[model samples]
Target: MGRRAVFDDPALRLANNLLDVGRADLHRRIVAALHDSPLEESYVGDVQDQLAAVVTDQRVAERDRREASRLIGIGDDLLAAIGRSGTVLMVWRRSPQQVDHPGQNMPLARYESDGIYQGSWGDIETFESSPELRTLAEALNWAQRRAPHVIVRPWWNDDTHYWAGDGPPPDGMDALPDHHR
Candidate 1:
């Protein structure tokens, strides 16, 4: 498949980007060429093996190992989503900041639909809901129950500042429509 096709497929692109591989090992020498190849079944298996090795190598950086392990989980989730017939609900969160003390394990809802929507908050960690939760409402409800201390917002918006919370949005802010609830 061409680069466009690879980019169009979220699962494939994510696998390639996490694996950080290219058409051949030679391309690895050039940082820019990394993740330029399509993700094949064999490549996915190899990448999983490589990530597993990273996770088990004591000499590797602790952060790298943790990241590898997280990527493995994401890869597994992506594969499962691809195999299933329904939509996959993913929750993501940004690290807490001074003004925004969202507490521990709080999810950050994006104002946009893109899966990798990182605004001023910086990099965010993604969490995939159980496959059984097929809709956004289910995901939001799950998040609300799982982290009641924190506020949750809709996965996407329609240019308006709509948000979802245990109660109606405070004062001036707007709550999500009835259907979204």
Candidate 2:
């Protein structure tokens, strides 16, 4: 089995489906879909190149790579859910440069409600020093214990990024669900 960490996150259930289908079949379907896709031919060639570099098989490597792209694209709905519900506490708007290991990536979104996409915003933040973040947080709060702090920072967990929340902020920002340590 892969050594990937198993999270309690339900937002990624659809993406997890990719792992269920075997490698060969997934590649076959993905390549066919890409061929029929209305996007540019260069895009298809790029995808094919990526698969060729990573996948051992020549016939369907492009197919598998395309499948991975589909998995990630459809999975964005999960990210949007996290942002809408504020469960994605502090996160980078860009991918981290420190991908020392294979599968390392910026924090994915998670639902605080009924497992799947159904979730509530917990603590949201935009890229550092946003002009409208404060008002957004206030409007979202449902007359509870003052609004939480949406730690507005660049690169959520990057070396330059550092944010820590204590549940709901005394003034505003609250702890984000995806906040690491």
Candidate 3:
């Protein structure tokens, strides 16, 4: 048989979904979809560039342009998180109910350890900071105290996780199922 068409690629689906989604819910929808499987650095960069162009294109709708601008911010953050190096710092955003306190959301961070199986990650210590530190940047800086130069990844929102000192992730790690959420 000839080569088969693969129609289930998440990245391709994401792109298609982006085209069909309403402008109002664009950013949140994209974020939720990306949380399932983050795009590669190159793809993220490409999409960001395309969105940037859309933002500046006079032909595009004003609402669409605004939505594109917002997505560019998401792209920038995702790009930064993926580009980090050193230890693997996984940060999770916890809802108020999930935390000891009931007032606000909090950030929880943990480092990835080498698992028993080769090319697998094991869980180690976890740090749950006070609600005062409200942003991912704050959480990352706090977690940095335990391990400097970490490849910070949002745990519940992304699948690619690697240990400190590990160069690029091994093949297929990006395809890991959505287990963190």
Root-mean-square deviation (CA) per prediction: 16.7, 16.9, 17.2
Whole-model lDDT values for every prediction:
0.41, 0.32, 0.40
Q: Give the TM-score of candidate 2.
A: 0.20
Model 2: lowest-lDDT 10 consecutive positions: 1-10
Positional deviation of 27 in candidate 1, in angstroms?
Answer: 12
Q: Give the per-residue lDDT of model 3 (tens digit) for 1-181.
A: 0001111133334345555664334434334333213222354565566566657767557776776776667556642323332343444433333567676655543322211111111122111222323444554444444343344345344444533333444553442232421
**What lDDT is obtained when candidate 2 is compared to the true structure?**
0.32
Question: On residues 1-181, what C-alpha lDDT tens digit does candidate 1 reach at each position?
Answer: 2212222233334334444533222123222322434333344445555566657767545765676676566556443323312222234323334445555544454433333221111011222233323455655554444332223333464245454545456676676677766
lDDT, residue 5, candidate 1: 27
Off by over 4 Å in 2: 1-63, 80-132, 137-181
Q: Report model 1's TM-score to 2 decimal places.
A: 0.27
Once fitted onto the true fold, the runs of candidate 1 whose alpha carbons sit more than 4 angstroms away are: 1-35, 79-181
Error of 1 at 147 (Å): 30
| Count of backbone clashes, every candidate in sequence | 0, 13, 1
Residue lDDT tens for model 2, 1-181 = 0001111122123223433554445444434433322222243354444334324445434655455444444333323322322322333344224557888763452322111111123321221111122222332232122223334333223334222333544443344335333
Task: Give the Cα error of residue 107 in candidate 2, in Å.
Answer: 36
Relative to the true structure, candidate 3 reaches a TM of 0.29
Sort by lDDT, best first. 1, 3, 2
Better of 1 and 3 by TM-score: 3
